[model samples]
Target: MTESSKSAEAVWAAEPSTLLRVGPHFRLSDVDPAATPGFDGDEADGKRELRRTNSELADLQERLWAESRFGGERSVLLLLQAMDTAGKGGILRHVVGGVDPQGISIHAFKAPTEAEKAHDFLWRVRRELPAAGMIGVFDRSHYEDVLIHRVRGFSPPDVIERRYGMINDFESQVEQAGTSIIKVMLHISHDEQKRRLSQRLERPEKNWKYNPGDVDERMFWPDYMDAYQAAFERTSTDVASWHVVPADHKWYARVAVQRLLLQTLREIDPHWPAANYDVEFEKKRLAAS
Candidate 1:
């Protein structure tokens, strides 16, 4: 096994509260991350869950398309966080990808650039904020203020403390502007992560995604866990809540993501756009020529 995988395996076997990858004062062991309680998605189960998840995702995408066409008033912003191999991409591909591309966008934010560091941490985030009548997704998000920043000592302790308050207010402002936030943390066993990471490294198509630095991050599981716990404690609220998604099996993660998205879209009640007869008439006329 690769060194990264081995590190994840150790964390997987450790007690849940020992790891901190997402929110404040939150521990993986405290709650059930399963979409279906008592679920087990070993190899055979993975296949079954994936099929169900795919159908659900397709259906929701259809709904989003219909809503967008109908001139809907609401917008949504979905946030996903996890350790490496947490299935963020898989969830996006299966659940939201088929939705009207014009109405949805995916932004996967990484470490700050030199320009990003010059301004307040929230500046880069504000630039990515979505407009009205659209769905925006963050593969990882500003909660990084509390998770990664705290772990790596990027910010002073007091500054980090202030950020939690700022984030809560920022989310509230977004809601007032007709955007809702839905956050998900993909929870995976360290063993499963090792397995998946190995698969990615071995596959020629996925080799480009494998990074050596990822292993270094893996070594500080305890520090990572502490950061996540603190972040979750401060940011989780009714307006912008966080959901822990068990991701040992990617299929299950996709399904949970689908369900969360469908629910959010249902809440938004996006209206489909009305048709204009002259537009179609002009199209047919051009085709005849």
Candidate 2:
């Protein structure tokens, strides 16, 4: 590895302790979108670190898969929640994309269909939970019921308030059942969001990504921030803690998330299972064949 590569690895390797960690006292407004916590390196370092982290994550994911095939029940779930244009898609593309598809599952939750709306808010979400030995990515998750519903008044105050506890209970149950949860909130400045939205309009290829309604939603930026604060207060729990990732610098956000995944997987420490059959016998059988 080059000097830069080594430095980057060191930075990422220490992230679990050095990075900003969300807890009950966490406040969204206190985070600086421009700040690159736990990583003092520049964009070049971040890019290089991302490559290394991706390879490590891919290897870990494969190990987790192998362990499951041999009867391990543990898995990982990465729940990503962010405002529009806050780099969730970028993280999915640049970070999670490096892992094996069979070992990872991605679910992008949008406005619920009528049939989905008929059931409890979490019904659709529960159905999509990742199985043993896989990494599940929720592009937008059950938090939307609280976020959008709270912001737009689609649900009454009591209902919105109740869903928070429900979400916490749901996550706790899933965690106890062997799925490790890593919840992340991508933090970006209002100005940064506007710039990204403008870019979407300016570039022909990005036109499809832009929604005029996003401008309407921007009108409620403060409301959304308040909603997010409420969410962190109510739903960020020990079983499924939230990590607020500063996302003004896309490169930094991507690398930070990669580091977070590495940390989570390292903690899980999925090992290769011993062969159930006799290794020597299998080797002899193969030789004979």
Candidate 3:
């Protein structure tokens, strides 16, 4: 097996939670991502798991949409963060793939524009915050302020230190305003990432997805890993907890996301809007005529 595979194998064997630093002094070891019994291979297994998870996600989402129709008092936000090839795209695809497009909004944060930097870090993020009863997803999020910016020395040490508290308050306010935040860190082995990158290079259609810069970033895996550990500890809260999913086996990652989303949506449990037919009034008018 490759190093990534070994990392995953090691993770599976780690303490109850493979990722110990994910939550509030809580290890994420409690999660069991081994493919369910009778499941197929890694490739086909994900598809099968997707089938069941999508159905439940769709049903719950439909309820949220109908609830939103009448206006719910609350909403949800999901943040996806991981190293490249950690399966964020696939998680978004499989987890929210069946959700109502109208009730769900996805925002991807890329290199910032001058306008974004002109305002506070949370300024750009606040605009896309989900409305009541809606589900908003960030492919990457404001955590970059602390993660990439800190690691790359984009900001001074004092300024970087200031952001940790700022971000905590920022998320806390959103939660107080009725938007529950769910943050996920997709963890994968370095070797697996190399494999995925190589696969992209060998495939003609996937050439566009290949970025030479990604390889450069991979060189500093230790830095990014440390950055993540710090980010999760400082930012994860009772209101905005982080779920770290192993991504070396893409199937396992998908299953973890699937379960998490289903649980969150069920917690929201928005009711369907009541239909008003008014057929009785119409029939009386027709009879009189």
Candidate 4:
């Protein structure tokens, strides 16, 4: 295993909480996109471990679902933020797709509609929050309000500045209400992004995935990085800290995310809810029938 992968394995096996955690001191430039921080394995090993992690995640999700049916209060929300072509869809398909669909709620936020724009930025976000005992995944979340808005100058400087505190407060409120948040920023290098974008152009089947706007956005990559760095500094709070996953290696990214989810679920430690009825009476009644 590579030294980076060995380090990754240690992080996941021991203190997974600190794995890729972003803080006020976080520098986006300091992270190495090619480095695999937690798993001690090759691609094949990653795939195998991912399958195992998926099994555990699926079981935990089912238990959480059952607990919710019995009026449990806790749930989990995974908010994914990344630059284009950073493997958000892959994470969805490989990691989250393994879980029971009934226990998972996924929302892919796009440009707001006319009606949606009438309200505050978080109005739509508030509507999409997962209910008790479920796992929610946000493809692109309220962070977009800060990221895109900041990079493209869509929102005023003062308003964008205010949103940092607003987001922190909002997340704190959600945590207080029993929702554990796992926020991830999939970090990829500029060269890797170019390679992925080129593949989109070369493969006929992937042509649809290419957006002209993606190229236009690339011009502002530096600005966007600055915006993300500012966001991490302001919004990486105790309630919902950000995890910056190195995403150049798709396999490593998938495994790291799976491990992060497993760690969160482990902390939640949901159990199957106890039956509320008398087992002997129900068995006897059923036998009579």
Best of the two (1, 4) by lDDT: 4
**Can you write out model 2's per-residue Cα lDDT over 242-266, one digit (the tens) per residue?**
8899999999999988888888899
Clash count (model 2, backbone only): 0
TM-score of 1: 0.76
CA deviation > 4 Å runs, candidate 4: 1-16
Residue 193 lDDT (model 3) = 89
Q: For candidate 4, write residues 3-50 as lDDT tens digits.
A: 965653553544435969996678999999999875666788888778
Q: Please list the C-alpha lDDT of all candidates, in the order they appear.
A: 0.70, 0.90, 0.75, 0.91
lDDT of 1 at 156: 88
Q: Which candidate is the best by lDDT?
A: 4
Measured against the true structure, the TM-scores of the candidates, in listed sequence, are 0.76, 0.95, 0.83, 0.95
* TM-score, cand. 2 vs. native: 0.95
Worst lDDT 10-window in candidate 1: 11-20
Model 1's number of clashes is 21
Residues 1-289 of candidate 1 have per-residue lDDT tens digits of 8996464233123222122224455665674443343333354554454454455445554555665456544678888889987788887776677566776778889988999989988888888877666678998988888887888888889989999999999999888877778878887766677787888799999898888877777777778867766777788777787777777666656655655666576566554455646888889999999
Candidate order by lDDT, highest to lowest?
4, 2, 3, 1
